[model samples]
Target: MALTDTAIKKLKPSDKCTATRPDKYSDMNGLQLWVRYTGVKSWVVAYRYQGKQQNISLGLYPFISLADARNETTKIRNDLAQGINPKDERQKAKQKDNLDFDHFAQIWFEHQQTRIKPHTFKRDKGVYYNHIKPLLGDKDIYTVRLPDIMAVHDRLALQGKTSTAHKVIADIGRIYDHAIIKGLAPNLANPIPRGIHKSLVEHKSKHYPRIKITELPKLLTDIDTSNSEPLTKFGFYVLCYTFVRTKELLGMTWQELDFDNCLWNIPANRMKNGLPHVVPLAPPVIEILQTIKSWHLHDEFVFFSNRGKDNVLSSNAFTVALKRMGYKDKMTGHGFRGLASTSLYEMQYNPQAIELQLSHVQGSKTVRAYNSANLLPARIKMVNDWANVVNEVKQGDFSTYKAKSTADGNEMAFISFLQSLRYKEQEIQDELDIHRMERLEVLAG
Candidate 1:
């Protein structure tokens, strides 16, 4: 029969000299009340773990109430469902260090400062504090199991933070890595299961919205008239003028700009490909930079956060503004890249120069090395030309937005025509008009 609180209070233990015996009554589920018949009793749970039968003493009865015993029994069963042995977990916890998970993770986070870029650290720190800490901060590193991590992932996934759920895989995974690295928990395994990210919900929404080249005029006019933050509005212009990734633009610092050289040098740590990228600024872009500088918005970064200088403008700044401008799903911050690529490809700028300027990774090692730095002149010309084309489009001057004609015998035009003829980059005729080559060099300079 099921035991109740009245019966549990009535329970009594039977005492003996050596291996004493107690009168036992099965309570709810796996819990049983043991009575010594001497007004003393306790609780014990019996279960199987790893092909062996195990009995664990819960605690003295009355102190561990009937409700507490039932709750703990359910918890143990849940842990077993995830292949976790509660007995083994308790054993590990006994061996665990005095420091909790958050304290150790904080130390690891600080140590990572010299190893990662500022923006990356900011993002990782957010994950650590917002997602992981609440659930696992006080958990002993050795006692934290796969169920704990899955709980964090499930919480994020349920809240529609699937991308953050995916990121959590690495966030907590590294904490265990550093713990092992520092010899803190030598026997502790990473509670996060490997290949666990495959099961997290994927971002199934439309990736980004873009406008056609024909629709460029409307996007430009709407941006100029946007009633958003001034910096946010200028962001659209910079996106149009430079076509770099939005994060790259948001993280733009005064230290990265070289006004005299008309260049925006992005360090390798901030770049996607881990290669330093240089963007040649057009006259329009230089003017925008000057306008932003006049605001004195930040001491270091161009896009300043209202919170503090260390914090940056929200990543959603443009997307939120776009929504307010009534473009909800019809436009996005990243759409600028697609628009620029479409315009340049149609304008007959060298494909190599366009791709290089877009910071695309080249397939061929030799070609990548040859194009990485060697395509700057073409990139500069392309930027200036595209910037002008955008300006003209904004002014409704479609007549001047014509493709460079290959039939015109202009040296660069001849070169572009020659490039169009090749299916793949192959050896071309070495013969060229000496006067045309000289003129081409002068024009390039």
Candidate 2:
């Protein structure tokens, strides 16, 4: 007999515990509402495919209501009419859950290699092969639970590599996401749980080695006189002047420059933050670029290699040159970013202008979405001020620089700093007086 919700609720557990006749209500088309002796209710479907009978459960009881159960039965009857067996297809999906994680990770890496930056992919590849794959490669993706993930984190953390431990787990999470998106593991969740790193050692992000702003003069002297190739030599100088990331500097193309507007518009893909950045070119950088443009070596890349199959210079070009200039393990290409940001803030420029110029992703999502070229004029002014310092230091002059401690918003102290840079006392006084009256008139307005 067919089943109804009211009658199914009144049904009792089997006295013989389903050992006698089947304790189930057979509805129609081999579909039955099953009641175990322990009072567990379930909906089951029985069908024939290739002349063999098969059974599968739709779901468990009041959860799978009468109409829902009937709907599942109708679908199973339709599958039998089409000669398709649900049980065999179910086995195929279960087999996919047993897929080796290493095999799946390879597919994910291939997709990433063609999509992400070479350097970024290189880092992820190293982490996977060195740390993650060794631990999780032999296991099935579905079977990698929190304990297995914690093992990967603990192994690296034991070596005092907390930052790397954080990165590999993120990579593992991304790989699972790729699998799900590709329909390989459709019903599985990412094994790397979120916020799992909080309970263990707090990840202290590492910074590249840096030199103080006072060291710029000697570094500039070495860069100008280095025996490196001309593009690489001047590329280091321009890297200091612009302070863009090493990759962004190397990946610059001739078409990205706007000489008339004095701006360099970096495209979204090249930027680490995946947002387009506008670099205000100072007169000093423009002079360096004009000199590079005069080389007429490669029409495509601004910094092309005379020796590489890719036509552009290698990514490690700066590090190699820095080491050659006797700055190994002391100052890296990324150090210029930290140096410039600190020096600029010390110079009393607006902090927002400094951060946006650095291409840092900050503030809330909504604020970031609307802030594509925020603080343009302030950034232009700040970069010009910074470039003047670089240009002077490039010419072997260190007297023009002022540390933050010596000059912090004091007119007299600034005047004394200018005097120390060899400005005549009277000239400094006149300049300050002119600006002071201008400020007064502006305040009156």
Candidate 3:
């Protein structure tokens, strides 16, 4: 017979000189109220799975009442019928409790070390140590939800470390993804969901702040007149005219240059995107290259370090030059690319040609290869046109350039050519070129 609430309430422990042994009273569906002779009461379920008897604890007396205990017992009997052992399931859950976020993050970092570049590995390690491990490290990864991760992200953003916050979310997501693949946290959702940046306030997203086109002439003049070393000045000009990345500009070898073809072919290993990049040498760029070659005579790299011949220039060399030129916050070595890109677009140059000259990935691998080949002639013309603009900046400011909006319908040509190149209407309108339509009208007039 099933025990009643009144019977359980009236029951009392039998006093003894030693600790009292537990007494079991069975109810329907493998449920039992186990009472100690000392008066303590608890609930348990006894069942047989695969021909063996097993017991799983539910909880204490009043907390897990007779009804609740019976409900749990029915669930266990259902498990037994399905050949599932609740004891083993509980053990698995306990194992997951030991798998915390920090433990898994360290494992993920160790595995990634062998796959990525040494510099990249070092940078990622800094991100983990500085941002991620402090807050979520000891927490169980399975228990970490979106709000918990978002709290850390928001804190970093509030401190104006927006890029760091973005990186933290990405790194945490990668760690969780690795955990799932390794069967560590299979059921836990990634706290940092995809496209979460859409929800975060968009920081201006300037990797390097560049000056406006109209401001370029003064900057160029300062660079030319600055008492910095000739080699530094030459490197600055090469960076400006080539518009290559700082690392690409610093790590150049004479062997990579084909003066006859007026090109510099950056090998795949040296390139960030792991594809060979070709930089066209305009006349002025070639002059600066020749000057740099003369200074380096037998040196392997064009820009050798001041400390030693074998070592290339320090990465901070360009930054130092920018500071000397009073362009520390106004511009950067990377900013040259933005300056070149903006000016080229506003000049109504072909977008594909400009993109090719910049070595930006245009499309699929086969498409990129085809575009690289087909885009060369157009790139040569585009680079020369860009060089001419830089030369004009070196010459003087634009006080003489006049305004005429229609330019005999040449403004329509801007819309047509940019549209043919597949630029969206809004994107075209947003370009600095469109904004400079008034200035361009003055120049054309």
Work out the TM-score per prediction: 0.56, 0.60, 0.65
Q: Note the clash tally of each candidate.
A: 8, 0, 5
Per-residue alpha-carbon lDDT of candidate 1 for residues 61-170, written as tens digits (9 for 90 to 100): 55467888988889888878999998887667645645688767866876896587644666787787778988999987778888888888889889888878878877
- How many backbone overlaps does candidate 2 show? 0
Candidate 1 accuracy as TM-score: 0.56
Error of 3 at 142 (Å): 2.5
True-structure RMSD, every candidate? 19.1, 20.7, 21.1
In angstroms, how far off is 333's CA in candidate 1?
3.9
**What does candidate 2's lDDT look like per residue over 80-121, in tens digits?**
778778776667855664588887887797798668765576
Q: Is candidate 1 or candidate 3 better by TM-score?
A: 3
Candidates arranged by TM-score, highest first: 3, 2, 1
Candidate maximizing lDDT: 2
Candidate-wise lDDT, in order = 0.74, 0.75, 0.74
lDDT of 1: 0.74
Runs with alpha carbons beyond 4 Å of true place in candidate 3: 1-98, 191-195, 212-215, 307-310, 314-316, 326-328, 397-445
Query: Once superposed on the true structure, which residue ranges of model 1 sit more than 4 Å away at CA?
Result: 1-107, 204-206, 225-235, 246-261, 266-275, 287-325, 345-352, 360-370, 395-445
